[model samples]
Target: MKPIFDEPEQYQSAVAKTAEALISKFGKLADGKAWEAARMPNLTRSERAYCEAVAVRVTRLVRGGSVPA
Candidate 1:
């Protein structure tokens, strides 16, 4: 199916919105579970990639390192 976000700006906006929602829901301590939850089947490849990046950034900011063991 065709993705909703065709333009780069639209994609970025969607990614930022997803990240903000995840951060708000999971708080500063967003873990691997949060990242997993963000992975919806409907997301396009680029959206998933951006979400992964946000997850990593959030994890680093919260734990000051990679995700916990």
Candidate 2:
């Protein structure tokens, strides 16, 4: 079995891919509450957190808010 915290690259890749897909589907009107309502059952808590962060960043950017560096 894979060790916890041993696959950062894979984790980031998965998050990025999922984020892109979510962005494409939701576009500029993406809503965190709506996304949470439709959360994927297969993702772990950490994965969900990362995806939610991406969604928040996207939403902020779309609304002309600056994302923190």
Candidate 3:
């Protein structure tokens, strides 16, 4: 699929930024699973919906496709 960014440089930068943010927020991707586990119980229905939307956005952004692969 075509990249979401206009150029390779932009794509690399976007990936780097995503990685950096993930690292900052959760130390590493492993922590992401932990975070998800910790967050599940406290989510209200509306909060859960918002989280699902954000997950879909992130998936599309990284996969460079609007629809799920």
Candidate 4:
């Protein structure tokens, strides 16, 4: 388990690997910058759509028994 905000080399490596795998499998995210854009406090319709899509995909993948990392 990683400590919060530790930013260890292993953690960075794992994040990069996971992102690569997800992008490769999903073929470019629909709202790649949604995370940062969502900090506006009032999300737009497209932002909501992007978040929902991401949640659904993640849930389906987890339910499918492919434990990420």
Candidate 5:
């Protein structure tokens, strides 16, 4: 397990992998900036849609309090 922000390398790698997988499964991403774009406070409709589709996994990721490290 890895803390998304505390562990920068792992976080970016995870995001890249997730983005690639998302692209492969769902046509194409509206805003293809997987790294920088994700840091934004507000995501576009397409990004929101993609996140909402996968939000259920957040619980699995959370261990006790944080996202595992």
Candidate 6:
């Protein structure tokens, strides 16, 4: 598939920024698995939905297309 960014530089910057944000918020990516598995009963309905939406967006961007081999 075509790249999301027009050039490699833009793609690299986007990747770095996203990685830094994720790491800052959650230490390592493996921690995310445990976090997802953990309970969160305190969240209201809207908050839960918003969290789910953000998770979906992050998942898509992380797992989406790649540089051609």
Candidate with top lDDT is 1
Model 1 lDDT-worst window of ten: 60-69
Q: Model 3 RMSD to the real structure? A: 10.3
The reply for model 4, stretches above 4 Å from the true place, is 1-41, 65-69
Global lDDT of model 3? 0.49
lDDT of all the models against the reference?
0.64, 0.62, 0.49, 0.47, 0.45, 0.49
Per-residue C-alpha lDDT of model 5 across residues 1-69, encoded as one tens digit per residue: 544557767655665556446545543332343333444569877565445433322322322223332
4 versus 6: better TM-score goes to: 6
Kindly indicate the candidate among 1 and 4 with the higher TM-score. 1
- Please give the lDDT score for candidate 2: 0.62
TM-score of each: 0.49, 0.49, 0.41, 0.35, 0.39, 0.43
Candidate 2: the clashing residue pairs are none
In model 3, the worst 10-residue window by lDDT is 26-35
Candidate 2 per-residue C-alpha lDDT over 1-69 given as tens digits, one digit per residue, 9 for 90 to 100: 894347877755655565556667777655564367447788888667776766666666557777554
What residue pairs clash in candidate 1, if any at all? none
Candidate 4, residue 43: CA error in Å? 1.1
lDDT for predicted candidate 5 compared with the true structure = 0.45
User: How do the residues 1-69 of candidate 6 rate in per-residue lDDT, one tens digit apiece?
Assistant: 765345666655554555446646665462364236233778767555444444444454455634232
Instruction: Give me the displacement of residue 69 in model 6, in angstroms.
Output: 26
List per-candidate RMSD values in Å. 6.3, 4.3, 10.3, 11.3, 13.2, 9.9
